[model samples]
Target: MKDLIFDNFQNAVDESLLRHKSILDIITKLQESEGRINRAVAKSVTNCGCIRVDAKKQELPKEDDDIEQLSNALKTHIEGKLCDSCREVIEHEIGNNLFYLTSLCNALDLNLYDIFIKEYDKINTLGRYTLR
Candidate 1:
């Protein structure tokens, strides 16, 4: 099976949706994702056996720290299937993620699609990770 270049492809979803909408369309995708995520979450939890574990005691990072402990911790929990599948909620999260990626690209004067393509191509050619 072919590996997906964008493991979380939803981050770019909003860019496609906004192709025909005005600037205000940015908020549209965000709101849409929020709704979808909510629904998915609700469905997943309806009858699933899930566990919620609090992070072990640890000191908070200092202001100048570059770490994102919370995000990393949440991702670990999610991947561990601490909860069941929530399709509706996942959809919105995917869309909103794409929207943010697109926004970041625009801010940096870069093209997300092109960047992704180029990165993939480089990865394929090198057969391993290497700085571009």
Candidate 2:
């Protein structure tokens, strides 16, 4: 198989860590990075919601119409260049999500990576329990 490629924002964020000034720098950098990633996710969600509203605005009744509303909304958003409102929505949405996750991690004494690994191993190993 050909070499795999990652063309996503998350990949870019991960790759950026190598260029940091020092290992100590990574701690601060990581906090900033996660905030940014969560923000980006939020914006995309907001854009999707806006698209949905726009699609609903454009709806017309027809006999036996069975198309998914959100899918149609997405098409409308893309075609209409609905970015300004979507951008605001994304910023607010991402900010809130990032804030909550950061707060929860701080309060709960959780290591996201460790938790993720434990869950993933359980998923893969089906009834086999392993000591961490």
Candidate 3:
């Protein structure tokens, strides 16, 4: 057996670290943007009592099995309530964000859940509070 070593190994590791940091920065920006979007959506839906009425009509299941069905129904109702332009804009922004996120994950050989956990830990360590 022969021992083989690459001269640029340090450079490769440093580059990977840089990429990881960049990904983290992107995640932070995305988190902030998501908070803003959520606030705006909540404000917009405040006056629309129909969502509450519909939600109240449904008999929410106690078991976890029907959670997905309930989630889909709520999402559909919210989308229906959004104006066409608002819906299109929201969908487009989400699609673009996901595209970049997946691409970064692929390049870094990481999954979204892992990245989210890492970011969450970082935030907690920094004494920041996260909603989730």
Candidate 4:
């Protein structure tokens, strides 16, 4: 059922994508979409003032601390949540990123769902060790 959704999205992208059909075009567009996402987030912080980023060097857990403690010690440095307008813009940009990502997979004759499953299986099998 989940695979069906991913397959349909890939098919939709393949069918609707007419201008940027070339692999090179798709790759560059994919890169552009990533930048757009970053810009949207930045706008939310700078323009909308809905969120604030207070990023700094991360402090590590004690040497004797467990993996769970390390996880708990980490921070995203983002305060508050995205407002509706900022959230919508970010979601749209991310969708564009996925479209090009699927296009790249299509051009390379790869199954997007299979790639997802492979990653999922690897993470599931590796658990916390997958971080490395």
Q: What is the C-alpha local distance difference test score of each model?
A: 0.53, 0.47, 0.51, 0.95
Ranking according to lDDT, highest score first: 4, 1, 3, 2
Question: By how many angstroms RMSD does model 3 differ from the true structure?
Answer: 12.3
Off by over 4 Å in 4: none
**Higher-ranked by TM-score: 2 or 3:** 3
Tens digit per residue, CA lDDT, model 2, 45-77: 564543322334555446465444433433333
**Candidate 2 clashing pairs, residues 3+ apart or interchain:** 43-90
- Model 4 lDDT-worst window of ten: 123-132
| lDDT, residue 82, model 2 | 34
What candidate 2 gets wrong by more than 4 Å, as runs, is: 1-50, 53-82, 116-132
RMSD of each: 8.8, 12.3, 12.3, 0.9
Candidate that scores best on lDDT: 4
Q: Each model's number of backbone clashes?
A: 8, 1, 0, 0
What TM-score goes with each of the models? 0.37, 0.29, 0.39, 0.97
- In angstroms, give how far residue 128 of model 2 lies from its true place: 21
What's the lDDT of the predicted structure labeled candidate 4? Answer: 0.95
lDDT of 3: 0.51
lDDT tens digits, residues 71-120, model 4?
Answer: 88899999999999999999999999999999999999999999999999
